[model samples]
Target: MLYYEDLTTGRRFQTASHTLSEDEIIAFASQFDPQPFHTDPQAAKTSVFDGLAASGWHTSSLTMRLITASELKDVANGLIGMGIRDMRWPRPTRAGDTLRAEVEVLGQKPSTSQPGFGVVQLRWTTLNQHDDIAMQLETSIWVARRPVTTTEPA
Candidate 1:
């Protein structure tokens, strides 16, 4: 597993793509966020989005899934999230839109209270097939840190 130090600023990782279907969007929204724009494709035409759209939470969940299936999961040890900030869905995610994620390391700092771990700041940007941003968020994750080693004069 990669330690916290391995995650440096400007480091980026891309996740595999997952296509969202109309049926899937409806199903997910119906359970969590049952809004017309998300659950009813017909009614969505009249909604602000002008057509069917996936719930922002659904898009976030899908992004998390993609991350877990990528190298970030291995390095960060399954995305031990501490908290999130500035989560925004700039554009709607429509059915048939293939989604992928690009995760970048913004910064990292050793945990002051916990010596064996550290916190890494990451920016997660989910994009559609057309490269429109579906969702973006900054989150803090806990990553195991390699112990510092020092040598004494032999």
Candidate 2:
């Protein structure tokens, strides 16, 4: 499992791609966002997107899934979020778009209150197959520090 010491500034990684289908977008939006542009293809054609689009929340959720299920899966415990910052959806995520993520470790700092834990600042840039940035966010995650192990006297 990766610990706080395993991450450093400028460290980068990527996640596997996931293709978003029309059905998936509609289903996700219908349950959570419930907007015509997200739930109805025909109605979306007249909306600002001019086509069916996934909600920003859906894009964020998918990005989180990719991150947790891919490179960061080995993190100790899990990617426990402290908070999110500067989240933006630059472009609408269209149906049939294959999405991938670029992750970068911005910084890390030991927690003052928690001796064995630290906070990692990370940036997640979500992109579509066409290389368009669909969503981006900066977040801080709590990560465990490497445990100290003492060897017995031989």
Candidate 3:
């Protein structure tokens, strides 16, 4: 596992592509989001998106899956979601659209109160098949640092 000291500002990781299916979109939306654009093609055509669209939550979930399947899994220091900030959906993600997540390390700070933890800020941008950004957000997570051995501490 990568510790806080191993992370650097501006480091980036790309996740594997995930294709959205109509059934998956509707199923996810029906349970959580329940928006016209996400649930029905006909309703979506009149709603604004012009066709079936995936829910933002579904998109976020897919991104998380991609992150876990990538090299980030090894570096992750136990995710502690502090909540997202400035999240925006610039475009709609439709069925059959392949999506990928790119995460960048924006900043990191050693924990002042905790000896073996630190805070890391990350920016996640999701892009569709056409390489257009569909969603973007900033998040902060508390990560564990590599423990210091007795000899190393001295």
Instruction: Identify the leading candidate in terms of TM-score.
Output: 2
Candidate 2 vs candidate 3: the TM-score winner is: 2
Model 2: lDDT equals: 0.95
For model 1, what is the error of residue 39's alpha carbon versus the real structure, in angstroms, after optimal superposition?
0.8
**How far off is residue 67 in model 3, in Å?**
1.0
Q: Candidate 1: RMSD over Cα atoms?
A: 2.1
Error of 2 at 22 (Å): 0.6
Per-residue lDDT tens digits for candidate 3, residues 1-154, read 8777766799998999999999999999999999888998888998778889899889888888888888778765665778899998899888999999999999999989997888889999999989999889999888888887766555
TM-score to true structure, per model: 0.93, 0.97, 0.93
Please state the error at residue 110 of candidate 1 in Å: 0.5
Cα lDDT tens digits, model 1, 1-154, are 6789899889999999999999999999999999999998889999999999999999999999999889876774657899999999998999899999999999999989988899999999999999999999999999998767999999
Mark the 10 consecutive residues where model 3 has the least summed lDDT. Answer: 71-80
Candidate 2 lDDT by residue in tens digits, 1-154: 8999998899998999999999999999999999999999999999999999999999999999999888799989699998999999999999899999999999999999988999999999999998999999999999999999999999
